[model samples]
Target: MATLSASPNPNPNPNPNFRSPTDQTDHDPESLPQMELHPSSDQDPTPNSNRNFHAVLPTPPEATAPAAAAAPSLLHISFNQDHGCFAAGIDHGFRIYNCDPFREIFRRDFDRGGGIGVVEMLFRCNILALVGGGPDPQYPPNKVMIWDDHQSRCIGELSFRSEVRSVRLRRDRIVVVLEQKIFVYNFADLKLLHQIETIANPKGLCAVSQGAGSLVLVCPGLQKGQVRVEHYASKRTKFIMAHDSRIVCFALSQDGQLLATASSKGTLVRIFNTVDGSLLQEVRRGADRAEIYSLAFSSNAQWLAVSSDKGTVHVFSLKINGGSPGIDRSQSASDPVTSPHSSLSFIKGVLPKYFSSEWSVAQFRLVEGSQYIVAFGHQKNTVVILGIDGSFYRCQFDPVNGGEMTQLEYHNFLKPEAAF
Candidate 1:
C-alpha cells in the first residue's frame, strides 16, 4: 500500500519482446513495482513480523536495503491448495500474500542466517517448511524447519542426509525431495512412512495430491524422464515413461486423476490419466526450448496453468470426460496437432516438430524470462502470477474466445517503505 522508493524507477523495460500467442491476441505487459528490503536485528528468536512491524529480525551485520536494481530474486514460490494465498522465498526472508486482493498477510524476515531458499505452506497456514538459500545462507541445507506461525517458533523439523530440494505438504503427509530420494512422513508424528529411491533430481521435483478423497504422491523415477506415482491408500505404485528427454516439470490434479508433465524440450506438455497412465491430452507452450518453472491444475480440474523461463504463462482448458476412456496411445499419436495455421499443419506428421504440438487454449505473455509462477484462482476464469522480480498479477481469462487474459489487479510486494 506504500511506495518503498522515493526516487524514480531505476530500471524499466521500454519494450518487451514476445512470441506469437498460442491462442489469443497479445496485450500490454503489466508494469512492475520497485521496493527495497533489509532485515534488522531481532531479540525474540521467532518474532511474528506480520503485525509487529518493529519486531526484531536479526540479519547479517553488513546488510542494507536492496537497491532498486538489486532487489533479491525469488528462490521459490508456492500457492496453497485452496489457491486463496501464496508464499514466496525472498532474500530477506519469506512473505505470504492473500491472492484475491493481492496484499501481504505475513512477512517474516530470516532472523539468523539468510533468505530461505525453499518455503512451502501447509493446508490453512499454521505450519511452514523452510530451507536455506538465496544470497544469505540461513538454515542448513539438509534440514527443513517446520515453523509454527501461531506460536511464532519453529516447533519441529525433518532432517535428511542430503540437501533438501523441495517440499510438498498435505493434511497427513509431508513429502520431502532430495537429490536422489523422496521421504514421505506422517505429518502428525513426523514418523518415516515410506522412502522412495529416485534418479538424480537436482531440482527436488515432487508433487502430492491434496484432496481428502485419496492420497497420491509423485516424484522422479529411477529412469530418466520417468515418473513414479504412489497411491497411498491402495499401496500401489506405477511408473509412466513421461518424456523422451529428462523431465522438467510435472503437476497432478487435486484428486490425482490427471497428471501433466513436460520435458527439457519444453515444446509439448502431455496430460495423462493417473489411474491407467493413459495419455489424455497434449498441449504446446511454444516451438522453442525453455525452462519450465511451474505447472498447476485448477481446483475444479478444468484448467491447467504453466509458467516457464520464457516470461509467459499459458492456461489451457482441459476436456475431461467422466465416462469415455482416455485417448488411446496409438490413436493419440496420430491425432493431428493443432497448428497455428492450417496450411503449416496440413501434414502434421511430416511437418516440423514445432507444428506437431497442440497450442495453448489461452495465453498471457510477458517480457521473456521474468521467472514466474502461476495458479488458478478460486473464482472461475481467474489466474494469479508471482514474478521473480516481486511483481504480482491477478488476471481473468475468457475461455470462449481463446485469447489473452486481462489483468484485473496488480501489486508490488516489495513496495512497502517499512521493508527496511
Candidate 2:
C-alpha cells in the first residue's frame, strides 16, 4: 500500500520532560488521562496524523514486501470479549471504539509510524496486546507489546521466534498464537502457564471462554478438521471430529458451554456440546462452498451469526438447550424466529439433504468478495458487522418477521473524516 502523506504535527508536546518509547527515559511519572477524541477541521484524516499523543518506538527491519494495491487501510478489527467495544489496528497505531453508540473512545498514534497488525483488548480496559505489522512495522513482528493506556507506555513485552498471528485476552490469562504453536500466560504476572502445538494454524484460529471460574479453550487438534477443547477447571481435554475438511472458523459461546464450528467446505455449521463433545445442532450456510470468515453465538446462545466471502451475513436460530456448566439457558424460548427451509423438508428422508437444510432467519448483503466478521451485538436482536474495507454496520432483525435485517447504523472507521 502507498504511504499517505501526513502534515506536520500542530499539537506539540507541552511537557518538556515528555519522551517517546525510543527515549532512554521510557517510563513516565504521571499517567495520561483518557481524552475523548474530537476530530477537528484542521486534523488530517490519515491515522498517522491523529491528534492523539505520540510515542517514539524502535524501528524494526522491514523484511515484508510492499502491501498489495487492494490491501485494507485498517490492518485488523476485533470486538472486545463482551462486544461493548472494539479495537482497530491501523497503519500507524491502534484506535479503540465504543460499539453500542458507535464512537471513538481513544487512540494511540506513534510518531515512528509503527503499524499495528493486531490489537486485542481485555474487555474495554486500559491494557491491550499489540503486534507490529504492515509494510513498515512499529516493533519487531515477533514481539508482542503489552501496552498500558493509563501509563501511556508498554508495561511488558513477549518475544517469539516467529511472527505472532493473533492474540486473545482474558482477565486472568493471555493467549498468543503463532504459526503452529500457542502460548498461554498468566496476565497479572505474564508467567508462562501452558503451551500447545497445533497443526499449521496460519490464521491463528483459537477461542476462549470469558466466563469467570471456568477456563475453556478451543483450538485445532492434531488431526485435520478436529477441534480440541481444554477444560481447565476439570483438568480434561476433549477432541471432537468436527468436519471432513480442515476447520476454517469457529466461535465459543460466552459461557463456553456451547461451540459453533465451520469447516473449509463452509456449507454446514455444527454446534457441539463442549463438555461431552456431543453434536448438539447443525445448520446450513449454503449449498455451495464459500470461505467462512466468522461465526458468533449470541450471548444467551439463542442465535448464531455467520459471515462468509459470499457477502451475506446469516443468523440462525439455535434450538439446542445449553444445560452444562458456563451455559446460560435462562432466556425463554417462547418467542422464536425460525430459519426458512425448503418446501421439500416436509417429506422426511425422501429427497436430497439439501432439501431439508435450514437457512438463515435474517440476512445482510455486503460488497461481495470483501472480508468481513460478524458478532452479535449487546442490543437485543442486533448483529454487528465489520468489513476489512473499513465498513462498520449495526443491523437489527425482527423476531416476529425474519428475512432482511434493518440497518441501524453504518460508519467508515478507517476514513478519519468519516470516522469522527
- Top lDDT hit: 2
Could you tell me every candidate's TM-score relative to the true structure?
0.77, 0.82
Flag regions of model 1 displaced more than 4 Å.
1-73, 323-346, 349-356, 418-420
Point out the worst 10-residue segment of candidate 2 by lDDT. Answer: 60-69
> Which stretches in model 2 have alpha-carbon errors above 4 Å?
1-54, 57-72, 323-334
lDDT to native, each model: 0.68, 0.77
Backbone clashes counted, model 2: 2
Per-residue lDDT, model 2, residue 181, is: 88
- Quote the lDDT for 402 in model 1: 64
Write model 2 residue lDDT over 1-420, tens digit each, in one string. Answer: 101112232333222222332233422212221222222333232353323323653332121212212233688899988887888888877778888888777666665567899999876556678888898777777777777654556545666778899999887787999988888876655556788989999999999998755789999998999999999999999999999999999999888888999999999999999999999888999999999999998888888999999999999988786445545555445556566788889884988888998888889999889999989898899999999888899999876578899999998876654434
Task: Looking at model 1, report the run of 10 residues with the lowest lDDT sum.
Answer: 1-10
User: Cα deviation in Å at residue 418, candidate 2?
Assistant: 2.9
